[model samples]
Target: MSNHSSSTISAFGYEIIRDHILSSVLGKHENEVLYWAGKELARKFPCRTIEELVAFFVDASWGMLELIKETKDGRTFQLTNDPALMQIGYRSFRLEAGFIAEQIQQIMGYLTECYDEKREKQQLITFTVKWDVKERIQNTIPNE
Candidate 1:
């Protein structure tokens, strides 16, 4: 998971570890743990802008992340992976959601959260990210 790691893993290999191995080890707490892990990852590899965030997703082999909509209080993103990856059984996107939430929270100085909805027919996931504009965090992480 290191940003500077020279090694690369195939999509199938990534799925094996992420979907099979982690699921077996974490069981019912898989989603929750992955979410926090993703947040920690964001802290380690911070993205200063939406462009950098999208690039990070691609580099991490998470998916192609696109900002579909934006509002004063929130934003909506669409994530799509390789069609072959979609056929590889069940998958959860909570990690990606948490990553986006934490990144936005750090960038905006707000308490942000994100949730994802699977668009099965479209073979994509939609992430809705929201923040309390009225309740700002006292200490926001500065971009490095």
Candidate 2:
């Protein structure tokens, strides 16, 4: 057994590691990117408010939203495998803009993991979509 201590994790250390991982591996910050991404997707997917967004999460059986708080600039939502770990086990998201579409747009990523936790062996799923919503719709004009 290793003697490394997990108790001394500083807020700054967590921020540093989290920021690095999100920006490098995930291509987004947990808040600035992942959180907002979920929010955006939720908007696109058609949930009215944060509560509905959370309910959609529950419907998908993606843990339960233990805590959800937002501001004009962004939002923070958390889900957990164990309801007791609302403090530790929950995952979060954040974004700059306030709109239903933001949450809807980013929600697919969260949904992507819907089948993951129960699998004995997991597989990578690629997420691709219309990054430019307006442009894609504009480009697809049927001409006979």
Candidate 3:
């Protein structure tokens, strides 16, 4: 059987933030350069495996992994609201934890819509986030 689950991007969307990040922080920095900051951010959120790390970021709504690269210096993922990589947000921290991975590409982005939905992970604490855009990226993906 084929596992066909649907998803979408909306309120608590990354539009406002992504735009700010790309314009203000990322600036004219080609997708390649900003990836510089991305690698740093990924490290902050310590994931045991790259797969977990990729899953964490995409599920974490830390923008979308538009692109990922590694030079002689380091590795990075260029995330954005690609629409192609849309997903459902967690209403609580617990729910965000047991979240599963998607079949979509590892790199995706966020959208600007407004709405809410039910949860399959009932034992999880799901909450909408208006995450502060200050700590753009961290050294590891803490258990926060």
lDDT of 3 by residue, 24-90 (tens): 7644453444343443444354455547655665666543332244333223333343332233242
lDDT of each: 0.86, 0.37, 0.34
lDDT of 1 by residue, 6-73 (tens): 76657778778878898899899988988898888888988889999999998887779999999999
Candidate closer to the true structure by lDDT (higher is better), 1 or 2: 1
Could you tell me which 10 consecutive residues in candidate 1 have the lowest summed lDDT? 83-92
Off by over 4 Å in 3: 1-12, 30-33, 62-144
- Which candidate, 1 or 2, has the higher TM-score? 1
| Residue 61 error, candidate 2, Å | 3.5
Model 3 shows how many backbone clashes?
27
Worst 10 residues of 2 by lDDT: 111-120
Candidate number achieving the greatest TM-score relative to the actual structure: 1
RMSD of each: 3.1, 14.8, 16.5
TM-score of candidate 2 to 2 decimals: 0.31
**TM-scores, all models, native as reference:** 0.89, 0.31, 0.33
- Expressed as tens digits, the lDDT of each residue in 1-144 for candidate 2 is 655443334545555554455557665344455545654554455654557766765554344543344443333443443332222323332321222334433432222111111211222111122233332222121222
